[model samples]
Target chain A: AKAKDFTYSNRGMTLEEDLNETNKFYLQSEIAVIHKKPTPVQIVNVDYPKRSAAVIKEAYFKQASTTDYNGVYKGKYIDFEAKETRFKTSFPLNNFHKHQIEHIKQVLNQNGIAFVILRFSSIEEVYFLEGKHLLSLWYRMEEGGRKSITISEVQEYGHRILLGFRPRIDYIKIVDKLYNLS
Target chain B: AKAKDFTYSNRGMTLEEDLNETNKFYLQSEIAVIHKKPTPVQIVNVDYPKRSAAVIKEAYFKQASTTDYNGVYKGKYIDFEAKETRFKTSFPLNNFHKHQIEHIKQVLNQNGIAFVILRFSSIEEVYFLEGKHLLSLWYRMEEGGRKSITISEVQEYGHRILLGFRPRIDYIKIVDKLYNLS
Candidate 1:
């Protein structure tokens, strides 16, 4: 394989960039208003230099308590986490935090649309796994059954995302189909 | 008045803190799932010490492109920005950006609940101003009218939030009434 051929995951862009571009497109096209929450950081120190912007001198990344992306789409609340895994056979459960699982359950209880977007980077494939499915998987894990959902299981329970140029990955189309927006 | 009396806005805690507490209470009680988005920061440089967590060496705060607080309530998409003003007579228009205005408009168009939580700190009064009302005020400003929405106008178009111990500011009750959630 040519070295450049390896860059086929949405043309060398990670799922994050693809999602950002998708969100930007969504906003511009008035399709949706989702946004990835800012990377959480714990600022320890800052310096207010003369005639310059305040500079954070000491800081650390903090784990997000909620999903990465959230917004309203067609009168419904949308929430989801996007992850890229190199593992070919399965999507690992360790990519998620316990609180995040709880958060998804809470969102489901509130009747909000929540899900996980998993990108199998090695295969350049993406899937939209619903919040309920994730919770069921978590429960199964709690029962000491399986630590990860196999790719075949994901294929059975999740919708595959079709990538495109306009919105990069058209996840919203999958969402609309899943949630019956249309 | 004693110096300690100065700490009247939710016992010296800022509106942000108060809202955070309120959201936490709501989450715990299964009333709602709102959260203040983390302060946006543009991370520039980072250092990875062998045995320590990655340290952000340089960063700067970035103006938020959307409203701060967003979540689900009674299956509705809720989004809002909270601001406290020391101005006695009015809430200034400069507290919002153009894109935020656009965001609120788009959210409203999608049939989501959108509003601004305003605190007139001098009097310790907080009002939930509807997104449509805010858009009207912004339009008025664009038409060479008032640059700020007077307190009277806020009182007319907004619902006053009662401060409470458990939630700090019971804004959800106002939302329930305003949007007929209950």
Candidate 2:
């Protein structure tokens, strides 16, 4: 029923797609309530025709001030940003904006579960990097260190989510494990 | 600095504007971290020019599947939708959609803070209707009750939020009082 109205492209499950499906599964099963934030667009011009819906004629994409996704699970606030890179060895830090980093820190200060999901699309590997480690890595970059996190560093700092059939990404399993939610 | 980039219109602070400013105040004061979700737009066409940003050529607004404002406040997930009605005596229920009601219920089931901020524009009065009361009211409407909620009914089920100078709405003050937040 909901599928009829969902008009987004289905390009064989990118990280966002898999996470969206996983969130949907969680929703249907009453396990959690999560959603991806819509892309922020700056509307410059709008046209209103008689008896017709308003159409945005000119708009530009704006950088998101917060992470891509946020919600609640088992009374815990959940927040994360998802990104995929084709690089084989590392995930580039440039994929994240400064405001997003600051937003993650704010969530952490509020004792919320904050993290990032990085995908190495070349090898089909997805890893969840903890927000603490991300902050530290971002600080290192600010101090003129490496601008990317190696695959091994991600493995050490984060957990790998296994792809599933029903939920697609099964990220809450990792969330449960990460937060010791039992 | 952020004001320069915040390109949205300012028309003497509508309910949404007041809420946005209030959320910004909470964020800056380190009292809470709430934000209004961006308006969802369905993109139909995009134009990318050489050495320039991609411009959205065609887009249409889509109904939101969740509440407008949400964030983490003192480790708890906060969610709500704010609406203003000019009807003076009653606020029409049609301002809320089915998905929004369901979204509030979902947030409640997860033990998150969920509610609606109703503004009686003509009377210059605002009320914070609790989600539980909202659900009960919605059920009554489904059972063929009044389509609008009277001011007295709202007062009985919710708290009156005093408009503040700094935060504009100061809704969290009511939240703290309602939840006995320490």
Candidate 3:
């Protein structure tokens, strides 16, 4: 018998797809357990076709109440939201919601790891910004400060996640470094 | 202006209504943060009516990837699933999916609080069964044991929750007791 070959390409994969694939690889390798939340949808009607997959007749996207990805990684509860922006100056505060900030605060209060993944899509740069930094900036914004976080600020405080093969995000490696797990 | 007088009803409300009311109370009380997860749906079609809510024309309910309720509670991570079953003998293991079980195990591995709310609708009884107990029984079922957990067994290991006016589930109370939190 020949050895089975399993390889994947990241070409043309959206951020969500790439993350999903990466998580799957991590799970199979027993490295981490992470999952992208399903898109929230409001459904009003449906059609059940005989001998065919059920078809959704009507629905609309709804804003999510929590972060995008959250799960257990190396004995720590990891929670995060990922966003892609084109602006180089900074990431807009409006990209996050008041409820999400509150939720992240609660997670942090409970001694869990909570953060945001900011992707400068224009330059293909991704940074993992802790919730504390985001919350501080968010409160400052509410108190009449700038409405976004500058790229230079993120570069200083957030861990830069270098994209790679196998586990594309390789966030756990960064998490290990940040949490001193290693 | 006269203060509005409100009358309380003893007649029970639907699970959905109770849950919503409970969530509001939790938010107001600064207790554990938890919310019923919105049902996942796959949409195939939709119609945007003129100056009105977008009507969903067709959609189908999708299986959830993680547990329904998860948040930070009393300096600990809280994660659980809510289910109502009419069966008197036990809760059907089939109520949960494989992915959900995997997710719960991951949460437990991270030292987080994980459990399920089993409501016997006919008897109006609710029990908070810990994830470890549930997982053990689930594995037993997979090994050709009873397909469901008996109410008596649940009563032995699970905390019986009394539905109340505030914090309907009062799950945090059990969590507090279990973890010995102040």
Evaluating just chain A, the predictions reach TM-scores of: 0.94, 0.91, 0.87
**Candidate 2's residue-wise lDDT over B1-182, tens digit each?**
33222222333568887888888888998888888899999999999999999999999999999999999888889999999888988889999999999999999999999999999876677899999999988889999999889889998888887676677788898888888875
Clashing pairs in 1: none
Candidate number of the best TM-score: 1
- List the candidates ranked by lDDT, beginning with the highest: 1, 2, 3
Please give the distance, in angstroms, between residue B22's alpha carbon in candidate 2 and its true position after superposition: 0.8
CA-based DockQ, model 1: 0.82
* Candidate 3 lDDT tens digits, B14-81: 65576667766776677655666667776556678899877667667778888877666654667788
Candidate 2 docking band? medium
Runs in model 2 deviating more than 4 A are A1-11, B1-11
- Candidate closest to the true structure, highest DockQ: 1
Deviation in Å, model 3, residue A160 alpha carbon: 0.8
lDDT of 2: 0.87
Please tell me what DockQ candidate 2 reaches: 0.70
Error of 1 at B28 (Å): 0.3
lDDT (tens digit, per residue) of candidate 1 on A32-139:
989999999999999999999999999999999999999989899999999989999999999999999999999999999999999998888889999999999999
Candidate 3 recovers a fraction of native contacts equal to 0.40
lDDT by residue for model 1 (B11-87), tens? 77888888888899999999999988999999999999999999999999998999999999988999999988999
